[model samples]
Target: MASALNSKIHAPGNCPGSKADARGGAGWRMDCDPEMHVKMCKKIAQLTKVIYALNTRQDETEAGMEALREAHQEELQQAVAETEARLLQAQGRVGEEEALRQRIQALESALELQKQLTQEALAQSASCRLETQERELRVEAEHAERVLTLSKEMLELKADYEKRLRHLSGHEAPRWDRLTKEGPEPKAEPGCGPEMREVLLEVERLRAENQQLSKDYARKAEELQATYERENEAVRQAMQQSVSEALWQWQEKETDLRKNFQAQEAALQAQVRKLEGDLEHRGRKISDLKKYAQKLKDRIQDLDVQLKEARQENSELKSTAKKLGEKLAIAKDKLMLQECHVTQKTGDMKTERVSENEVLRKENNLEACSLHPQQDQNFAKECPCTKGGTDTQTKKEACIETEYMKQKYEEDLRKIKHQTEEEKKHLKDQLMKRLEDLVKKHTVEIKSVRSSVEAERKRLQKEVEAQLEEVKKKSENEIKQLEEEKAALSVKLQNSLLEVLRLEEFIQQNKACPPRGDEKPQELDYQHCNILETQ
Candidate 1:
């Protein structure tokens, strides 16, 4: 019987009584005993159960693998999101740095412009001062020239008067000698006495006029010199005051500009340092995020490896089940042959065979109940056949136990798949939320930074405008003062010219009328002399 069973199990498809041929024949019929038919039906039922369990296990494993794939996809998405966020942050920091650099350049340009303006103003002031000084010196030189000319004319007039006086004295002595020799004869001439008296009166008057003229010329010259000196002193004082005030104003402006430049430079340096620090901090954060992403990638790789292994195991189980199915088909063919033989021998043994099958089924149920679920599956795999049992019974029991194991495996796989799906969903949601929050926070920070920069720029502009206004006011005041000083100097110059003209007119009038000794001097000439003496 064992040899027959072996031949049936290993039979080729082309053999006449082979399992394949039996299943293929359209008119094939079994003339089998009832007890043997029952046993074969039980084996068929067990094989079907095993196939159903394997299909269920395969579905569960596929589901579990799908869950693992989703989880890996979610991890990859999260990594991509984090990388994009880091890139955005880096770009923002770079933009901020560029803006700061532009602002610094603008400030530097403004400072340079201010310096140029200050320099131009100083040059204008200096030129104006030099021009004023030159004008004053010219006026002084003119006054000195007028004074010297007047002094030379006065000296020439004094020498002429002295020579005329000596001539008059010599002629008078000769006339007196002649009058003594011919006194009686001269008494006989008409009007001689009266004429002599008149001559004497005129000489006395001329002498008095000459003395008065000398005194008036000396006094006028002294007055002219005094006025010229006083004017020069006043002009000198004004020039000194203007120079001193200009120096003081220029000093004050320089000091203020220096202080402002230093303050602006310090502020710019601080802002640059702050921006650099922020860049460094951002770089560190990006590096840390990159490391975290790498770790996630490694974990995803491990999950992929596990999923491949699970798929490979599921395929192996399917192949083993296929082999078991082929064995069960061969066993069914052998059981059919044995049933035909028993039926030919007798029909009276039917009740006994049915009772025996029932008792064997009951014992199988009891054994299954007594074993733990895991142990039952392990026992079935390790010991498919018992020493006292027939080969068909052993195979049938092994198929049933294998089906139970497959069912358990499917249940475990289904549970694992459910858990993995939940975890994947939860992780995806968390990563998305975190990314959203980070984006919002970065946006808010960028807005605040922009506002601060604008405010600082406005403040700097206001300060520069105010300083320019102050400098303009000061320059205007200085120009006004200089103009006033120039006007005063012009007025003084006009007055000095008028005084010099008056002195020249007086000297010319004295030269036009001179006193005579022979004829009596006119009364008008005497009055003019008296007026000149008083002046």
Candidate 2:
């Protein structure tokens, strides 16, 4: 009994005995013989040892379950944190996409504005071209009208001079025929014979003077006709030169304007083409970005699915942990009941000892205690419960790895987005620079064209002015020459008319004389002498 007491005190099961002592009392009395008491003590010690071993196994199971729960909880928290971070990154990417969309809209609006400006400029150029055409037509019409007027004036002058020449020829023909037909006068009465002879001589002299006057008139008329024709030709040539110069200037101006307009149109078309190309490039980039965003969304959805699966797995693990804890509690309760039954049995069997049977029972119980550890080992191996912590750790690692992949993907997407933005900026800058250069080049060309046109116009105007002055001077000189010729012809006509009147007066003064044969002979001699003097 002393040995049994010492064993009981030293056994690992003594921890439960404190509760048992509290329930039963500090000391208990047993009504049994010494041998039965010793046997009961031995059985009690063996049962306590078995109970202690079972308790230790239950504690190890509980500790493993707790660790698994902690590991699973940690893994679940990490998954949740990673998911939140990915969601935040996704939202940031969405914001960047929205900003890119707004920039595209602004670019489209700017392109539209540029198109409108180009159209307006084209319309203005077309209107200006139409106006120039109308002005040219008007000038041509005015020039035609002036030419017609000049031609009509020339025709009228030619008809008037022809009529005057015809009338003068008709009058001179009758006068010449009458003068040639006159012969010697008929014999007159003796008293009027001398007067008649004197009148005949004087009439002959007047006819000769009239013939000279007609020849002078014919020469003057021929000269006047030649001068008029020359002046008309000169006037016509000058008018033609002026008209041709004006037409040529207009043609040059029209051609230059057309060239400028064509060049501008070509430049505008090139600019439009460049803008179109840029727009297409931007559209392609936007499409790529959209595709990338869609890919990101798909990845995010995959992550969400993974997260859900992880959450489901965590819930399943929690349920399993709860089941294990419940099973451990039931086992502990059974062990406690068994310990109670064993204590009751020990109290009852203390006075009825069968030594050999008790010894055998102790051996069996010792063997059961020894076998309990093996059962625990087998359970730990086969149950899959103890591996929960390792599984949770693996799942946590997977979750961390997925989070890192997600972060990498996000970083890659951000890099691509930034690269695309930089490319867009570079393209825009190049386009602006090209457009600015084209504008400056076109402006310089326009300035040079304008200056050349102005200089040409001034030179043409000077040439036209000089030609007009020369024409005026030539016409004035011709008119002055004609006036001088006309004045000389009139002076000669006046002197011939005075000489004819003096011969008529001399014939009248000799009309009173009568003549005999001798007087007649004297008269003939005097007439012959007068004819010789006149000749």
Candidate 3:
């Protein structure tokens, strides 16, 4: 019994009994059986070993679960990142398409504008050509009329000269015939000879004057013809030069317009080609995105299956841990019951006195032995609770963040809306002001244009009236001059007719006298010759 007591006092499992042995001494030790103490110690050792194996198995299972969780988290993060990247790419593509569409719309507008400009240019050119052509035709017609009028005037002057020459020739022919019928006047008297010589001298002077007038008239006609030809040639050259210059300017304008139009067309064509290529590339990218989405779907499905399997394994581990914990509790309860019976037996032998330090040490040892499983169970329980707590906290924080974002967004939106309204109002006011200003400007311009047009019309009318008055005055002056010339010619013709009649009367009187005698006839002829010469 003493050896058993010594062995019990030294055994690791009977540390609490050592305190009692120290307090009760040998008397308390003599009450306990050695065989029972040894059996209790062996049972405790076996229970501790079982507990250690359970704890190691649980730790290994937890380690495996932790690795799986980390892998799942990594996969989830990778998938999330990939999906986010794809979404961003899709958004970028959508933006590009929108931009391309806007560009196409702008190009179409520009093309329409170019077409309108070209059409306007063409219309203006056509109108300009028509006006120029009309002006040229009018100028040509006026020149033709002037040429015709000059030709008619020249023909009339030629006719007048011929008629005057014929009249002078007929009058001279009658005088010559009278001389011939008389068979040459006899120079029988001295007074007749002097009178005849004076008459011949006057006749020679009149013929010489007639020849000088004809030569002067012919020279004046030649000068007028040369001046007319020079004027016509100068007018034609001016018209040709003006027409050629206008044609060259018009051709230059047309070439410039064509070059600009062609350049615009080429640039637009290049833009269209570039747009088409971009659209094709976008189409290819869309197809690639579809295939990537399909791949993501497959990967998500696989991840879902893995998650389900992990969930099942976790549940199974939890159930196993619960069973093991229950079993350990029952074993600890049985060991506690045996220890209580041993303490009762020792209490009957003597007063059971336990030291405060030994009780504290015993409690600490019991806690240490059970701490692993209890802590594991507690940790397992706390894990979900902590996870749920963290999840709730995160959810709450997320909700608060979302609410804050919403409030901020609303505030910002309100501010933006207010700003937009202000901008709109300002723009509206500006537009209204601009519109009013434009209306006023246009109205002023219209009034000014109308006033200018009226003034121009009045000025043109005054100018035209003045030109007409000047033309009428010039025509009237020309008519008056022509009439005066006609009157002078009529007076000269009457004088010539009277002289011819007088000469005829003188010849008749001479014939009637029948040359009575040479002296009488010579005296009568001398009187007639003196009358003719004086007239």
- For candidate 1, write residues 372-395 as lDDT tens digits: 788667655644344224435433
List candidate 1 stretches off by more than 4 Å.
Answer: 1-61, 83-91, 151-218, 289-535
Model 3: colliding residue pairs? none
TM-score of 3: 0.40
lDDT of 2 by residue, 126-212 (tens): 454445445434543443344344334444544554565576556466644654576444344688567546655655665565555
- Top candidate by lDDT: 1
Give one digit per residue, the lDDT tens place, for model 3 in 1-535.
Answer: 3344345444434424445553553343343344444554554455456556656665766676677678767877887898788789878878987987797678657756765764575466456545644654564455445435544554555466567667756766775576578777643466556655665675677667656655654455345434534653464455455445544654565566457646655665565556556655655565555556545554555455445544554564455446545654554454454344444444432342235335545865777677887765565575467445544553354345434543653464366448646855775686567557755765675566556655655665566457446645654564475356446535644554464355456535644543221133244345434543543
Off by over 4 Å in 3: 1-135, 162-255, 314-535
- State the local distance difference test value for candidate 1: 0.57
Report lDDT (CA) for all predictions: 0.57, 0.49, 0.54
Decoy 2 TM-score against native = 0.33
| Pairs that collide, model 1 | none
Off by over 4 Å in 2: 1-234, 339-535
